[model samples]
Target: MPKMGFKKLFFFKPSPPPLSVSNNTFSDSLMEENIETARSVITECESQSPPLFTNTRQQAKQYLHAVITLQSTMQYLVERDSSSQKLVKAQFLMQIAMKRLQTEFYRILAENRDCLDPESVSGISSTDHQSSVSDYDDDFPEDDFQFAGDSFSTVAMADLKAIAECMVSAGYSKECVKIYILTRKSIVDEALYHLGVERFSFSQLQKMEWEVLETKIKYWLNAVRVATGTLFPGERALCDFIFGSPEKKIAESCFAEICREGAMSLFGFPENVAKCKKTSEKMFRTLDLYEAISDNWQHIESIFSFESTTSIRSQAVASQVRLGEAVRTMLMDFESAIQKESSKIPVPGGGIHPLTRYVMNYIAFLADYSNALADIVADWPKNPLPESYFQSPDRDGNNRSPEVVERFAWLILVLLCKLDAKAELYKDVALSYLFLANNMQYVVVKVRNSNLGFLLGDDWLTKHEAKVKEYVSKYERFGWSKVLALLPENPPAEMAMEQAKAIFQSFNAAVEETCRAQSSWVVSDPKLRDEIKVWIASKLVQRYWEYYEKYRGGLESVIRFSPDKLGNYLYEIVLFRAEESGSVSSHSASPPHRFKRS
Candidate 1:
């Protein structure tokens, strides 16, 4: 059942006087009558078949009234005549009332455990507590006890509060507080245990394997959410409501003592996990721990606000700090790993490098945690990148990316610099340029397609895309410069027939030699590959065709290629050609084929 609020039960200090008496100064007859009435009510409540506050709530109020009256009567007697038999008898009646009240208090807390559980009580809201003294007056019609409310939890909480007030007023707080702490503490402990939160020494964590530790970390991530989001808040609400108002200090003290050790154990686990060996592979788990604490920090501060429970809050903060340190260390180690790449073997066909794939994928995953990383590396020192490194204009103060963006961009820069060094392993200058283009394009695509695209922004992508074009331009210039340099500057300029035949023979040999050599060099991106092929064809085919038409009148014996043959050779540059589909007699040869841009 949903809970009802209990704010009305928390009464202020200097408790009101008994309903039967206006003041402490009572006449002898009035005092005797009050004492007799209190005795009779206590006697009947103790002997009643049903327990107090369950079926007979009206009688429960009568018992509470008698207890308060007996307490007042005893005080009045002590002030009037400390040695009189009346004072001693009133003290005896007060003892009986206190004993009866203690029994009911413990009984109500024990039997109403489910209704008074932290989860149920915390569900009670301020709006649900709008019922006033007049509202309860309408229900019971008893002016002496107006603590009753509309729901199961409301009635139970109201009864407990009344009993607690009477017991504390009668100097029986030790008994009342002891029962409360013991019962509630057990519930908190059991809930935590079922949630899989356990106390582990640093030695246990240190000795655990990564796989074992990772499982525990995953469980801790989920357990911390439940413990902070629901468990601790619920407990705090229950403690505050029951022992509230005049005895709020008692409530704080009780809660701190009960939950202090468990909370300390819970928040301290991440710190111990941080102390484990830092590896590039372990960084994500460490980051997960940091994010969990960061997400729940506000609740941690508010629920553990007591001075006595400050250590719980401190422990949570310490875990976040330690996890941050671990992440920073792992990131630095990852950068060093990138810089330390020493493999001499060039990628076959000038395709993407393995180092490039690994680092780009790693950085892309890191960008998924950009917000956490921004906080982690906020204070960590890093070298500033040069202004020329970025190609776009977003680097100004007004449009700068966050520290995480700068950090990620820097990591990609390191990978690119390492790739530049690796490119030197290729003896062919054109092939080295091809290798750089392939890897740089892979890195740019990885960033553009992932969360890195948002963190690094389009400006970063624009800068890198320009870099890919630079590498492609260099590859085309150096890889095909020899073939283009052999053609005449002016194809139609008058020249001797012998010189023209010599030029045609030399040009044909150079084109075949260049195409045969470049046939094996690879561009991994299909779009970029087709683009490079078409660009080479446009330059070479146009110039070669111009020279061929001008000199083809009587040089058929020397000319080995028509424009169509050259176009077919260009089509077969990067990959094998498809087989002819049918007999050649069905083909029309009217117009020569030419490579065109897509």
Candidate 2:
């Protein structure tokens, strides 16, 4: 994949810095008190006959609840004083509490295995229980917590200080790993609830207090460097807790920070680049998995549309179709805007600008892609058809209806004629029209079996021919020498141009005679008439500068010919003449004034 362009890449916005923590002895005392309370609870749980309570179920629930409450309180302290020594102390104490709870729960279950019946067991098996306990113990190795000295009084003060210092330094990572490990265990236990003691540690971690643990983990991972000096084994698991679990917002913040800070450089310590290679691979793998599952357009739409589950294949196809349609709509708007501008005159020249022509060609290409995608999406099997009996159509059977293709062809030709007559940007505009004609031919061929073919084959072709002849006749009678000269040559331009102008004049006379003879014709929809007027005015204004620039020669002549004329002659003629009453008396005469040409 190509790297994203710098212009398109969004920059990371930094968050406000965390509040300062006062390093007072009072703060330390408070932290010590919280740790002591937590320790007392853990010790009490450890000393119970079955380690916590008489009944395994009751003891499991009580111990689980106590761990949750203590964890919550510890989290509160951490958030309240994130950088304080007390907060560090509370984090370690929380880990000890979590460890004791897990140990007692495991010990009780193991001792009471005989009491456990198959009926009481849910998804839990002996293997699962052992795995959960083992993973938990791995996070907090026994040697890390054990006191080896025979007499506490005889222990050297220096040794005690060294141990405390190590604990403080290791506190954040240890607590994070334990939380990650125990959280996984709790999920298994919950899934195996009927087995006996369903741990609530997982449920407890879902609380807002979990953010404190996550923040500490993020800070530590971004600060420390071990021998290999990379994020530890459980780092991704903790990330999963933040992102994959229900606390999505927290995870988003964490992951966004990782991405922003350049996770590889966050720790800023001398370590092998290869140290983070595995962790980076794992992180990217997880991200890829998430994107695969979450970014499907069909899945996203289903969330809103109340649809039945679609097969993965169909979902993938629908996602592509949705994207194609979005691109088509955007391209269409761009084309329409350009077309509106191209209608305007170029400066000093009596035609459209060359840049406008370039834009139109690009827009035409976009339109072609849009139409192609639409056809592809339309023919994709919405309702499955058996393949064994299918046969591809031959040229005769595949040929589009002549009328439909002819109509589109004529429309393209008419647009070309108008563009060639009026636009200075002739080359690309001409090429674009040719491309449009070719694609329309393809569309006709593709949709031959559909109603679009019938329209192109008969109705469109007849209407197009009639409209062209009518416009030609009107142009001739109006003494538009340029229009007559510019008539297409392949079909005998001169003869057709003459007959067209006569027919146009006759049609205008007949329509006026009929309308004046009937009052009802004059009373037709006022709102519609107003809307038409507004639409014409908007188109004119949008193309005013372009048209004036392109057709400056002809426009200046018209302006000079009728100096007092309120609207440009071409504008009035194009917009109003076709719809005007035929009676010469009813027609508003052009201003008689004439001015010298510039």
Candidate 3:
């Protein structure tokens, strides 16, 4: 047992050397009641050479309570003391007693923090313990709460933070704040290092760094919440601490670094299209992370004022801008990568290269931006899409002629043109029309299926539809004109059997040439294909029927023109167009025995 010598020290009061009548007041003695018991404890320490050893932890805690109460008593006395010398002595003694009991109280807590029945060791009532310790011993207690090497340091910190809570209850707000700052810094640094933010270098990225970064960011933000709430204990104060000057600066700096990394990851995507495809995928993963930030953005704004000095807008608003930049960067990279790929295969090719389909599809998936596209598409009208919407040369207000309502739509129009031009490059003109049809049809279908269609209005779809029809008409003119030319003019009713056979063979040859040439062509729009099919079937079926009826029997059985095959040939001819033969459903099964001379 150590000697607690201060007991006697207070009793052996020095002779009153100083007298100041001007400052002496009745209140001084009144305060003595609050501090007298604490002063009397020193008298016991003086009579004993050393304090008796406590038999159990409970006794030690009683001694700790005596010491702690003595500190508060001394502080109360010091504030009332009129003499400067008395004040200094009182303050010094209070510090010593506080330091000693703090060590003692905490040591007991550390030794018995586990197992059971902690109050018995501390001698603190359950109510006192709740106010002193339980505040920080929250559910799902953090394991790595403090120093990793110390087995019980985490619990010790919890206990310490709980003690801080007691101080807060005692109205030591500044002291509580200091504790909060220290705890917050420690937790954040530990989280950042554990999640690898310490080595978060952007230019030289390691795989999965973003994942680690995101995890750490969540931990850090939550730590800030818990920390600020503990220290300030109100809605407004949390906002000021989280989004205010120094702390907000720290969060923004971290976010800025993250954005730098994200930009490097997305904007500086590899030149190769395959790599870009993977990059596009990786870029979208950031979307979720960004969405989390966006959610925070919304969450914080609602809780925090925007116009107030402490508002998040003053600092964290950059998060919104950074999110926008990431989105724009991704969109720009997508277009550039596809355009770069387009350069690989020159425009004006007859058939779209498979890579072209792949690149086009990449944009198709990005159609999640469909609403944005709708906004852009709405700007351009169905009639005369202007080359540019220029502002008033004549000083008119907002006078952009044919004002480009939607820039994104304009971008899509460019892509459409690029697709058209690429299809044009195909030497097989028929195949080129098919490529255009497929690309155009895919876009129209996607827009209609998504909300983008409404914003674009019906005109956009109608115009593109007309464009598709024009392309189909061009295809028919290019691919089937020769076959159409073989529509037999009204056969001379008296024509010789040999002449009729020769004309039928010519007609059969023309039909065979057309079918063989276009057997594999594809038109993706079912309606567009049906239109072309009807056109070809009308030109061939009715004319061939007339010609067959006019001449089938005129070709005598002796000529062996194989009258048995005419119906079958006619059926096959009308049911054509390689994509689908069944749209031409009206072909008669049998040729009429129209051998009577018409």
Candidate 4:
């Protein structure tokens, strides 16, 4: 009953006309009319004559009004629940509006170019003129933001074409290039941000959104080229943005594309390689993250593993071709420089002719290649080989193949060589090569005997023991001298003792393991077992005597070789007991006194 008052009745009255009702139609019709008004303004601006207004203020006001009206219409469209068709229509209308505004402004500016010099423009006192110019400069085409759904295609295409024409007409190619690059950057940033928000996986992105992003990037790069006669500055930044951004999902998808097609090759850009190298160097500086660079390199290696039939094979071939070209260039320069040096000085061995030097250099190059191949094999992911995957071809290509097992052994040898080189003031490279003799033996055994059972049999074990003993003897002869020479001239006695102790411990472990394994054959064959026992005894005796000589009766005697001596002593004690009990011949015992009383 109280609601029957005038205040309550006011709510029942008809509402005032909406600002959109100027056309006196339904909401939809009113919207259509507003859109038409916007379209007309655009058409008028597009068709307007150059210098339509002699006054700078008038020209400024015209540019300002056009920009504001276009912006307002864009907002209206964005708020409306338009269908795909309507959205497309709205986008097209906005595109036309933008084109008209830009064309008229440029035309007017060109005509009044002499009058609107920077200094003269700066001297203008009207705040409205300054404000209008500011707004004009501030206005970015709504074509970037206004398009909805299917409308994006039509608007985007039209805007691109118009931008291309504008750049061509303005003769501001450099400025256009910069704008294009910045625009591309912005688009990429936006895409990456959205991708992060969506939390898409790499595979998901590749199947779903990769093409869309790629299309946008391609358009941007093309626009840059069309706008500018030269490539964008810091061209590598684009590569980094794609490959090294924190939006991992997008970057990973981009990586897949890059892997499928050599990204640099696809883009026809070497700047990407420079970018990779730079990023790799930065990663390398942080020891903890060095593996990141290695991971990327490994990824590169995986891409190179293409069969002859796959599409990626072509990209691999291209990468190799580029590498080969670079190597050829380097070799040419090296040979030329060496020839110059040889020409100036009478070299040893008949001046070591250029061809001979080249041959030697090529040999060295092969050695380096072998070393690098070994490293790559070592670092490859460890998984059981797929049934159909082909093995890597060896340098000789004689049915011999690269295998990680042998590569691991070679890596150990390389590490030993590096340690030796630094440990000794001057390393004998021959000794380093000898250190790898064990690895070479393993490789030979692997090649000749593919059966794992045969490789681990008695004959293989015997050969392994012999090879190890040979290396041990060689190490013993020169190791102490090398260690002493490498140490500071007056190193502390404790330091020397520590070094000697470590060496003895390592050698003792190797000898003891070999001896113990060899002893296991005792129950199988008497004659073969006796031979093995003797060999084991001889090694143990040699190592024991070496330890005693170094340590005398000290901490080294007590702690350094205790385990080795105990093992040898136990063996001797068993042999004596067997002889005394008539369980074995005295001939098995060299001499009881040979064992020092522990």
Candidate 5:
């Protein structure tokens, strides 16, 4: 484990008073005097020695010492007179001490805020609002890490721990947690204000998040654990303070903020998984949240502490029989959002957006943890299977998983279905076919190349490859039919000139339309792309070649368009790259033209 930034502050159990002292009789006057001074102890803690309480650490140490002393005196008196008026006095003073710490910490930190982090004083706002000022451009100095000059941390950490100890020692677990919550809010708000958290870059946000979690929060949790976990059966415990009844006690130790906005909300996690997935910029945000939360959970798990990070990671996961309910909740929303957009995603002019590959890439990412995803589906309510299972695969020989579908596999299948459906909307059939071919080919290759193949079981790629062929076959039909028109069965020899003119017109139209349109189209794979260009070229040139020779009788007859010009026409129609459009000239060579990958 990496060393935490904060100095280690261990919690210790104070030994009980000697038996001789316990048996000592207390006069009513002395007992009354001790109870009267119990409240005054808090005042004397600061008043008696002003210098001792100057800094935060000093104030906390003395503050805790006074609280403990008052409690002991109060308890001793209460034992002799179980319903003493002074005991009530002692209780009120303890509450006063708690209130003072809470109020003073806020004020002291607020006043000295500039000394801790000047930038934060400006950008950090009230907890209710998130600051939009970005701290991204600032170069954080290494001095920020050493924290040698930090007057606030010393006071906050020490006093916070002291108060928690005093509370736990007095059997106030609820107050202990409340103290922790208040201390956390103060520390987090200070850091956030300083870091301009609301507008932090990803790198800055992650750096500070880990620092706060592993150090400050870690210390607070450890202190509470030591206070609560160390008590004997008769002694009061931290957990006891939290949940008094056995039935009411929960295994989880979630904080207020975690129960509300979640642990990552402070780190700028988007409002929801569905929201993050839809905004292309937030594409990887949920995955990042999962990873961060997962790691923090491990950090806590190494010990026995369960806290905010657990809830953050676990919020999406459902319990009950559906252990994977949380995972399904996050992923299912993503599936819905992506599928909705896939059909609507316009094929840009002749080019495909990188988004076409995102679905499969994300699937590959999901596939990395296929076992986890599979577990979720394995436990879903075993109602009758949805109709999606029986629906014939959309032209892709791929069918739904016959067994409980792994989340990743199910999502990928949905994407494939969407891709196929989207392809049908392209106004240009050849372009639509190319888009389908590109996406299908990409999905197949990605699955075969990654562990996605393992999760999806056998024949995932083979089935999608069959879909690619279906697309290719459709493309060939749409593209080649135009070229086939160039050789219109038989030309009447009776009206030779008129027949020749009609063939030339049809030939020009087909050549220009097919070439110009296809030249701009994209095919994602190198091998498949080359195969497509060759396939189209072969069909076009073979028939054109025969017509050119028979009609050319070598230009003895007046032909308006030259046979040599066919090469120029072919060259212009096959523009490959956007960059090559400026320089490429028409073909002067023979007509078995195979184009390069665009």
Candidate 6:
């Protein structure tokens, strides 16, 4: 067996008798007395029916100390008399005590497995330096390892650390380490099994159906969270507490070997998922996987810090890269779907198109993961858009990163461009304008209400708001231009009453036709819709009312609407509530007609 270093003898600090010995004879007598006391302690523990640790912890500590003291005396005898029978007897006693201590160590670990489980150990503060074996008392006091309370886990961990230090110190490290590795490894493996982590080949994952694969990805997400946040760290702490003293490499080496297989299986799943078929719906799940890995990366690096576990670290990083590629590719496909939208059918009532709804919904969902996406697409270049096209560069209070801001801006621009193409399918120029306004309003509202507003910034919202207003203005101008044309430019100094009647009759027919034709047109944004109605009333109603009053004496018999009735007509027709209200008949509700015989 390889020699266990002297540094492992944590409790073997022996101070000699403080009193001055008169001669070598007196000192020799003192040494023999100390050896006799140690031999007595060892013999009593061996003769007992119960194990030393289980019977009484103080006795266990005494037996350990006695064994260590015997080993030291044997070394002294070897130097003094290389062939002494006394040396043989001391060696025999030392081996017998070591064998007993080894059995006690194994029993403590096996019997207290639950006490040392990961979830319980993880609750112990990492900053609690008092819990380390370095603080152990040489005399093994009852309260030496008790802090908050004499908790079961606290005592068990303390006992494990004390035995580990003693066994390593006695040069029986090989046996002690073997028992520890086997027992702790079982716990780690079982914990991973309950977490639902399973190793899979690339072909198996790639060939699996998405429904099955998605369930596995969900399991992986939860597993990665618990494993990194609790399980792995707790195991690492336990290993360090047991074997970290005077040799940190042992802790790192044991930890690397113990957690290696489980961690690789845990992290390797994402890379295989990223390699599977890419779909629009799968993008968020892939991002979820990426975010999970990204979130726990710091703890992963610390837990598997050993050079031997470098492959696990590399596998995690590779999964991130591949997941990133998957997201980027899905984004490209979404953009392509927008560009490839071949529908020539104009949406009825000039309402929101399906393409508009799908793209906006997709983009809004993507906005929720803007920060994670910023890292994924850090190297993926943005589609080149004109500087003037997307002008919200200043994100002072914005939480989203610039790359994601620009990326979302480009995607929205693509959707708008697609909507612009679909608008051309409308035969009515006025309805086309209303189509643009409705879809633009939908996009602006989606951005304003979701995380996209914070990412795109107020400037982007203001720009799109301006576009919606422009569409509303064009729709009003084209839609009601003919009706407005029916009114005279000025109040005429008319001579004949017949011409005056003709003007009033033409005005009445034109207003009714305009209201009836536009009753079917739709505006989805309530605020914008009401604004359009008010603007139209201000322009058309006030002008037409003045014309009606001027011609009332000659044309009142033909007059069909009063100014108040005209305003109500505009409201009902614009809202398409004329049929619901049963008020679409010719203006029978107008005030009494007054025609003067001039």
lDDT of each: 0.73, 0.32, 0.43, 0.34, 0.47, 0.76
The superposed Cα distance between candidate 3 and the true structure at residue 573, in angstroms, equals: 11
- What does candidate 6 score on TM? 0.84
Candidate RMSDs in Å, in order, are 10.5, 26.2, 14.6, 24.7, 15.7, 11.2
Residue pairs of candidate 4 with colliding backbone atoms? none
The list of candidate 4 runs beyond 4 A from truth reads: 1-33, 36-40, 49-95, 98-360, 363-598
- At residue 253, candidate 2 shows an lDDT of 37
Query: Each model's TM-score, in the order given?
Result: 0.80, 0.21, 0.56, 0.24, 0.43, 0.84
Q: Pull out the clashing pairs in model 5.
A: 56-155, 57-155, 120-193, 120-194, 228-238, 316-326, 317-326, 318-326
Using lDDT as the measure, the top candidate is 6
lDDT of 1 by residue, 346-412 (tens): 7665767777767887788787678789788888665577767753234455433467777887888
RMSD of 4: 24.7
Q: Write the per-residue lDDT of candidate 2 for residues 169-267, one digit (tens) a residue.
A: 333333322332333333333323322221223234234243343343333222322201212212222233223322333333332332222222222
Score candidate 2 by lDDT: 0.32
- Using TM-score as the measure, the top candidate is 6
Off by over 4 Å in 5: 1-326, 342-345, 353-355, 375-377, 381-405, 488-505, 556-598
Query: Candidate 1, which segments miss by more than 4 Å at Cα?
Result: 1-29, 82-100, 123-150, 382-384, 391-402, 454-459, 486-489, 492-522, 547-573, 576-598
lDDT of 4 by residue, 140-193 (tens): 343433222233332232233333333333232333233333334433333333
For residues 388-477, could you state the per-residue lDDT of candidate 3 as single tens digits?
A: 421112223432222222433554565776776677567777667766766676666766775445444466777777776777677778
Could you tell me the TM-score of candidate 3? 0.56
Lowest summed lDDT window (length 10), candidate 4: 589-598
Clashes of each: 0, 26, 10, 0, 8, 0
lDDT of 6: 0.76
